[model samples]
Target: MLVRIVKMSFEPSKIEEFLANFETVKTKIRSFEGCNFLELYRDQNNTNIFFTYSYWNAEEDLENYRHSELFKSVWSKTKPLFNAKPEAWSVDKIASLK
Candidate 1:
């Protein structure tokens, strides 16, 4: 499995717009091929900061989704709301407790 984490910092004033946009696209993302899971999290101290935690069957699967029109449309709407560049990490599990 491939684990992907994306941290996004949004303009505070645009947080609501981001949230609404997320609501519209979250399902499409979750249903994408090879997607095993998807979730959203917010920073405790900074409401404008958020992270997306997702799992994919492989890097290629993730790449396919990233290149899809679904991603293009969602990102185009979401990118303008960012206050800073987004950070993304793609990792493989090393260890985990049951």
Candidate 2:
């Protein structure tokens, strides 16, 4: 499995609009091929900052989604709300004792 996290900082006034757009397409995203699970988060101390934590089948799977039209439309709407460049990370899972 692959783990991905993205941190985005949004303009104060644009957060709500950004969230609205995300809501519109979130269902489609959650059902996309290769997706395992997905979630969203907001920084408690930094109200304008948000993050998305997701699991994918593989790096290429996530890449396919990134290059899809669904991503294009969602990103185009979300990008305009940014206060700074978004950051993302991809990681491989490690074995657990359980």
Candidate 3:
């Protein structure tokens, strides 16, 4: 499995708009082919900061999603809300407790 994490920071005032937009597309994104898991997280100290954690079948599956129209559409709508550039990582599991 491939683990993908994205950290995003939105302008404090734009957070609500971003959340609303995310809610509208979250299901489609979670159900996309090769997506095994999808979730959202927010920083305890910074309500405007968020993270997306997801699992994919492989890197290719991730690439497919990145290139899809869904990504383009969603990203375009979400980009303007950012207070800072987003960061992302794709990692392999090196160890697990359970």
TM-score of 1: 0.96
Model 2 Cα displacement at 86 (Å)? 0.4
* CA lDDT scores, all candidates in order: 0.97, 0.93, 0.96
Ranking by TM-score: 1, 3, 2
Q: By the TM-score metric, which is better: model 2 or model 3? A: 3
Tell me the tens digit of each residue's lDDT in model 1 across 8-71: 9999999999999999889999999999999999999998999999999999999999999999
Question: Least lDDT summed over 10 consecutive residues: which range in candidate 3?
Answer: 89-98
Each model's TM-score, in the order given? 0.96, 0.94, 0.96
Task: Please state the error at residue 18 of candidate 2 in Å.
Answer: 1.0
Over 4 Å off, model 2: 95-98
Candidate RMSDs in Å, in order, are 0.8, 1.5, 0.9
- Residues 41-68 of candidate 2 have per-residue lDDT tens digits of 9999999999999999999999999999
Model 1 global lDDT (CA atoms, 0 to 1): 0.97
